[model samples]
Target: MSRGAEARQGLTLIGPPLFYALIMLAAPLAMVVTFSFWTQDYLDIDTTLTLDNYREAFSQPIYRVLLLRSIVISLVVTVTTVILAFPMAYFLSFKVKRRKTLWLFLITIPFWTSYLLRVFLWKVILGYNGVLNSALQGVGIIDEPLTFILYNANAVVITLAHAWAPFAILPIFVAMEKIDRSLLEAAEDLGDGPVRRFFRVTLPLAMPGVMAATIIVLIPTVGDFITPKLVGGTDGLMIANMIQVQIGRANNAPLGATLAIISMVVVSLIAVGIYLAGRKFGGRVE
Candidate 1:
């Protein structure tokens, strides 16, 4: 095939997928936007254009609390994951000499089980009659089970952080691996120490991955209901759970749609902002 023909062929192949994605995506978002502005008739939508849903969403103090709490938890999870993943990624990229695939597989082994099972596993480990308590008692370190370990904010953070650790690590590892080894060698030749070389050379180049990992981990968990519902009690209920309640229990479609739209909008904004932020994080020319 000629060059022009190949170009045309590739475009033809790509166009359909893009078109399909837009149709599938555009319709739902339009519906959400429409619903958010319409009035709620008790539990059903009246579908007439009005600002009740948005006004209701903004006017309520409870919704604001939930929104703020979700953001805070997401931020904590993002920060903690970044810190933990950085060292692991650094070791994986710079230190480990054997079984890279094996190590990666081990990291992903947690995925073999269902996510619900994973949350329950944490519950078991942190429960009063659970493994950690058993170990502590066995070792005579404590005479009683700790009340603060499970069904609290800290437990929520700890569980989400553990669940999201791999999300941060893999991206960072990929970013680190993408760096040219010659740059590091050149830095060392100029008398740059390990610490200097990392901050000056490695960190900057690896920043995109770090940002990607943060976004990847933080976004889903921000809207996550399962982990919080299963592991967290009253304190851990996020905006998603509230959305769920409105839709499931209250049978409030219009309000649920409004909440869903608001959540989606915020999540989309944060995701784009983070992705752009990731792309420009280190201010790297490339």
Candidate 2:
């Protein structure tokens, strides 16, 4: 076929799905961006463009605190998930000689149930008289149930980390699997210990997967409202929860949209920063 014909044929194949994606993804985002510039008064939306929402989102102490807390919580969850997942991924990739598929299946067992169910299960485990406290009491470890575990940021972190574990593991596992085993063997031959070999050879090559997992766990968790709403009480509420309140209870769509936009911008910047940092580190390793 002529190059022009081939190009046309490719466009024909790509056009529909691309259009669908734009409508589904881009349209809502564009609407939110638009809404951020307008003002809403209870039942009526004023079409007059204004910076009030943006100003409030930036200047208000509550918004600032919530946004900061959200970032901190997301960072903690990402770090915890990745740190825990790395060992499991390494075990599956290196230690398991057979039934790796079964192990992976087990890792995915959590997904078999509803996400709401998992969150509720964590709630039950962490509640005052829930399974964990009950278990501890049964064993006489504590005279009373712990109050710090549930209805707070700690609960959010634990639940999100657990939920995102598989996401972190799969990426790192794939990266490790792609690594050439001979590199580690060669490092060992060169008098490098197991730890040294990993840092020099295995870890560097697996950085891409680590980066992927980090981004995967970091982005969505930042904007997660449901987890916080269910398990996170007032002290645990994040930026997303504030946004939800603004849109739902407060009936301020413009302010909510502004918060959402600000969040997307912040998350995008952080994600870009991480990507660049990873690339620089990878380059040095190379």
Q: For model 2, how does the per-residue alpha-carbon lDDT over 3-105 read when each residue is reduced to its tens digit?
A: 9999999999999999999999999999999999999989999989899999888888999999999999999999999999999999999999999999999
Q: What is the C-alpha lDDT of each candidate?
A: 0.85, 0.94
Model 1: colliding residue pairs: none
**Model 1 quality (TM-score):** 0.90
Best by TM-score: 2
**Highest lDDT among the candidates is held by which one?**
2
Local accuracy of candidate 1 as per-residue lDDT tens digits, 21-60: 8799988778767766776656556767887778888999
List ranges where model 1 is wrong by over 4 Å. 1-11, 42-44, 272-281
TM-score of each: 0.90, 0.97
